[model samples]
Target: MIQKDSAMKLPVLFLGHGSPMNAVRDTPYSRNWRRLGQALRQRYGGEIRAVLAVSAHWCTDGTAVTAMPKPRTIHDFGGFPQELFDVRYPAPGSPELAAEIRSLLGGHAVAADFGWGLDHGTWGVLCHVFPEADIPVVQLSLNVNLDAPAHFALARRLAPLREQGVLIVGSGDIVHNLRLMDRRAPDEAGSAYEWAESARSLVNGWLENGDTQALTDEAAYPPALHLAAPTPEHWWPLLYAAGAAGADEPLQIFNDDIVGKSLSMTSVVFGHDALFEAV
Candidate 1:
């Protein structure tokens, strides 16, 4: 079993995993992920016990945590290259962590799930972050029935895990509008449409200002919300990261770029300023 130090509180991360192709491609985002991983090991001295991933892909009727010892690498997407499909993240799963999470959110009826494995959202980012696949990973499912505030409250219950040396990660894009994505547009900042850029800027402002209420209030961005996040699945993961963060913890934003005109590759790290310094 991995040892944990109560004094060593791990940082929380919300990664905007743009596409499955990033798993195999060497883009700026992928390189940043690698640097971030190196910085994490350097800052924490390789003491991170496990990762609790809240991915956008795994949504269920109710909340659940992956408990199986060995989690399969699920492609979970199509139209990708055969090489991408073949790429496996062979990370182990922690049943103990799953049980701990279930205990943490006891009132939520969180199930011990064995049916689902590491989907693209989780593995795609981890493949670049912790490529060795040695750390145990447990994924928590997003309860579809929960509203924005309830999701944030549910995530707040997971705050204790950070003190136990568990790195909580929420993997999903802040602005993920698949329908509006311009395939021909170059994957670079300033290549996005006016609306997409505006939406991204608005969300970034909220994050920077520590305005959790504005971030959770769907009605706050009305017409922009319709364009930026048509659906809440991708956007909800951000709340998990934000909610898990302590009120006093410093928030750092990275990979602040918009790709394909509609996808914002903005990621956030809560606490551990030293890690960013190292990166």
Candidate 2:
């Protein structure tokens, strides 16, 4: 069983980072992220030792962790404005933390990755969250070979880091279907396709009720799963955040809106109620 230390335990975040533009644009989503960061600093002060990020964009045949001391800001997507590409989050990387993470998930044979740096899924949201980029950040890659249950099981091993002041963050959209996106649609709640809204609601219900099993089980998914996800990479990061959280921890939902007619910006936090107040 994963042990919990209430006093020192940090919260787990699953942020739905929709577009690379959000990193530079001053939208409500980015504003909330900035507020969330301020709230974290206000509450935890310098106790936030490091960040362990699991991003949808970083997927590998097997699990891996970024080990480079000075990781570069990666611009993985194309067609974005030059301003977005120019944006850099110069966060320091922590090899010690990466090694510790590999040690924690020793069963998975997690590799030390020096090549892959912080992709948009990690840096895009983090550039707003911890704007200063002073904290050491280490990214864990999503193993495409593993199923949702397997990913969750692997993430459970890292729960102990919470007590050590590690902020575990999973960056991905709850419902992401790029092909069906309607760019003209307003970015707000209830503006998505019916299937997308249904899918988001179903997942939110499971999260709110603490039904982690339903989330991982394919049979429990709605019929719109194909339209909602299209591919599992984006949805899989949520499992990591849910798995690392204490079973009984209170969950707070934020930025629960859908944009582009196919992307859901529903974010959740396990523990740290003050953050909800901040945003």
Superposition-based RMSD of candidate 2 using all C-alpha atoms, in angstroms = 2.6
Candidates' TM-scores? Answer: 0.95, 0.95
lDDT at 34, model 2: 90
| Clashing residue pairs found in predicted model 1 | none
How would you encode candidate 1's per-residue C-alpha lDDT over 1-279 as one tens digit per residue? 334556878899999999888899998888889989988888885669899999999999989999999999999998878999999999999999998998888777999999999999999999999999999999999999998999999989999898888999999998899887877774655678788878888888887777888877866666776688889999999999999997568877888888888898898888854366323
Give the residue spans of candidate 2 off by over 4 A.
Answer: 1-7, 186-189
Q: Tens digit of lDDT per residue, candidate 2, span 19-96?
A: 888899988889989988888888888779899999999999988999999999999999979999898899999998
Q: What are the per-model numbers of colliding residue pairs? A: 0, 0
List candidate 1 segments past 4 Å from native.
Answer: 1-4, 186-188, 277-279
For model 1, the local distance difference test gives 0.88
